[model samples]
Target: MALVAVVIPTYNESENIGGILNALSSLAGSAGLNIHVLVVDDNSVDGTVEIVEDFGRRTGFVSILRRPGKLGLGSAYVDGFRWCLRNLGDFAVAVEMDADGSHDPAQLPRLVEPILKGEVDVVIGSRYVKGGAWRGGRLSRRIISRGANLLVRLTVGLRVRDATSGYRAISKKVLEQAFSGERSYETGYIFQVETLYQYYLLGARILEVPISFYERAGGKSKLGPGELVSFAAWCFRQLAGRISGRVI
Candidate 1:
């Protein structure tokens, strides 16, 4: 039996974290998998860490990792992944999900099944794939998501349905390889795209599970027009570097 760590990176998500944790707990039996959750909080001023600590005290499968400050999503995951590697060294799977209820914890088993069965190293919970869609997001966000995915596919040569989707499951081997070196894609959401591309480049098998995205009813989205713009620009720069042999 492979130990699995479900990581949720958060910042100012106090309102949503408890409910998400409860939902995740409820899925433990139905998922038919042993799972531990690691909530990496970025020192949210909203007392998010306190809530997480309280929950951790109540649940054996859940715990909290407090960071010093507001690190980007990429770095939060990186930090949490490293901790998972060290503390939960026996874990065979490491998963990433949103703390804002956009990603359904019920879908985690399907995303993790292929990796557990040794069919793939990376499994993406995709909202753009068949049987997948989003609800309650502004029209502009929908367009940005579609366009960003297309751009990522064309730029990185990764034929993934939702490159920007943060919901994912990765085999330990793949995570080890990806984080072994000094990561360069530490920018915006493009980090997700770059990580997928790096996995593709390294010949890691990838799988996609359909997912429906829902807008958060509370708290503000960290992603915005600025994030979208920066991501596009970063992708272009990365593409240029790759073409010129400046980056590999």
Candidate 2:
């Protein structure tokens, strides 16, 4: 059977980690998915590491990569993807998910199903797509999220509806191509957009699966003003490169 590695980046997500793990564990059995949950923790001061460790002990499928200090989200996924490449020789798909419960673990099957069927090289759990909705968030946040995505769509010219969504399942071939050559430029949330853009450049087939995005159930959101600024700056740089007719 082919294996799927779910890469979850964490920092101070103790409250939601265990429950998400348990939920994924339950779904794996029912869906008959040979899934492994890889939590890439950025040395959270909170007990996030402890919770993952305990869960790993009880559930052999859960493993973790503990970093020395807090790292950006893009690097966290890059590290996790490299680990999967080295260790999971049978890996067929790699998934990106949040530990904050904003992404529904139950919808994982929907995210990976198309990839398993060889329908697409990437599957994005999108909120802006048809049938997708952003369920709960402040009006300002919603506007910012929508605006950022629109900006990426216009600048990068990516056909993806949700270019910034972290919830996605990437085929092994696409993952290898995206990570093998030059390293990613952005290390923050903008990495999400960078990855999608890279996949597009590689001519990989992409699909968007509608999903209702929920507010984080517990703990604090890691996104801040700095990351937002970084994302905007990266987008502008990409736009400049595009206008200059240079490959980004």
Residue-level lDDT tens digits of model 2 in 1-248? 67999999999999899899999999899888999999999989989999999989988999999999887999999999988988887899999999988899889999999999998999999998899988877898888898899889778877677898989999999999878666755679999999888888899899999998998899999899999999988888888998999988
The lDDT of each candidate is: 0.85, 0.90
lDDT of 1 at 181: 70
Which stretches of candidate 1 lie above 4 Å from their native place? 245-247
Q: Tens-digit lDDT track for model 1 on 147-211?
A: 99888877766778898999999999998998857775574577788788788888899888898
lDDT of model number 2: 0.90
lDDT of model 1 at position 61 = 87
- Which residue pairs overlap in candidate 1's backbone? none
After superposing candidate 2 on the true structure, give the runs of residues whose Cα lies further than 4 Å from its correct spot. Answer: none
**lDDT of model 1 at residue 48?**
83
